[model samples]
Target: MRAVTYDSYASDNSRLKVGRVPDPKVGPGQVLIEVRAAGVNPVDWKVMTGGLDGMMDAMFPVIPGWDVAGVVRGRGPDTPDFVDGDEVMSYARKDVVGAGTFAQYVAVAADDVARKPASLDWNQAGGLPLVGMTAQRSLDRLEVGQGDVLLIHAASGGVGSLGVQIARDRGARVIGTASEENHEFLRGLGAEPVAYGDGLVERVRELAPDGVTAVADFVGGQLDTTLAVLAEGGRHVSVADNTVDQHGGHWIWVRPSGAKLAELAAMADRGALTVEVAGTYPLEKVGEAFDASRTGHTRGKLVITP
Candidate 1:
């Protein structure tokens, strides 16, 4: 199988390469997938640059990918829900759990693999898992629904874009914070986009005249800005950092769930959801894509096709 992996914790800005490697083996409770597309997330590059390598579970010479989409090539004896030839999507567990999907094959645990939405191609399917799962889980944590007013930061980025759409689908009126330039793009997605700069709180207040019922901060800076606009007791969920302070919300980590992924799949199947591919790169160029992601203004999900 051809894979893109670095031998050491090389700085992505300095050195990273892509080439061929051996295929992965499927162990008990795991399913082997012939990788088609891999979703590139911020964590992949962070790991590459030694951001996460300090953790005891992170190993060197690691292939840093979590989200995957492909056809099943093998299934463990205990994996009764699926068989070979099934199309699947998965986010390989990162801790001490497993490897990644940056290669042409990945052996992911069966519980982590969900049927890819039939309406989406491999790249879309691959890109949706991590960000969609994250957004869905974050909203779940926020408990957003009908009549609720939700505010999402970094509205044009991968998770935020999907988060805005999902919030609206669930009957919430979403107000998003992005740059003035991407405001139109976000408004098209059913979110009222506000400029995420000085006076963000004032701008958001103007949009939602009532009050922000919830805040999902995909952007890390400006905690005070989020707090200034949040309704008392409104959930302030942050994906990148702490959401805790005077606002009284929780810090959220994106959790992988086959069940939640199934729900997102259903929405996409019905055309209630859509994926915006900001860019596409082959596996060999993943490092370059990763570098771009860190720069802070991706229009949508960045993907890597193997």
Candidate 2:
């Protein structure tokens, strides 16, 4: 199997190299996928630079990716959920940072795998899991539902776009903060778009004079801005800032669940959710994919076709 391997942690993209590696061993409750596409996220590059070192250990010669959409090549015993040639996607992070989705094949725990949404192609499926899960988790934590006015920071982003759509699907009026260029994009996702930065609070206030009933911050450093526009007794959550807890907001870290993934896929199938793939690179050009993700300005998801 060929994979992108990095032996050491560094804030450098050059450390990632493509080479042949042994195929992963399939263990009980695991499924081996023949990789079709992998989503390139900020965390992929961050992990390469040891950003998650304190939280999780990495094995040497690490294959660094977590989002995958592929075909099931094989499965281990007791995995009754899938069989050969099943199309699936997963947030396939394991206890260690090796045997990742950047490879031609990756072994994922059955509990983390879900049947790929039939409505989405490989790239969209590959890109949807992580961002979709994060958005869904944040909305869940905020208890966003009917009659609530939801404000999402960075709403044109991968996770934020989905957050806007999900909040809308739950019957909430969505106010999303993005740049002027992405306002129409957020509008397409059913959000009232507001420009971020200076006057963001005022802009959001114009749309929701009583203050928003909930706030989900997908971008960091917006604690004060969130506080300024939040309605009294409203809920708040942040994936980017742990300090949100200090302000009576929940800090969310998404957990992989096949059930939740399946539910998201069902939403895609029902035309309630969709993914936008902004850029793509071949397996060997994963470094370029990482470069695009590191820019933090991509309007949609970046993907690697392996």
Candidate models: Cα lDDT each? 0.82, 0.91
Q: What is candidate 2's lDDT per residue for 1-306, written digit by digit as tens?
A: 888999899888778899999999999999999999998888888899888999999999999889999999999989998999999999998887777899899999999999999999999999999999999999998888999999999899999998988899999999988889999898888999988888888988999999999999998899998999998999999988999999899999899899999989999999999998898898788888888887788898999898
Candidate 2, which ten residues in sequence have the lowest lDDT sum?
A: 287-296
- Deviation from native of the Cα of residue 300 in model 1, angstroms: 0.7
Strongest candidate by TM-score: 2
How many steric overlaps are in each model, in order? 0, 0
lDDT of 1: 0.82
In model 1, what are the clashing residue pairs, if there are any? none
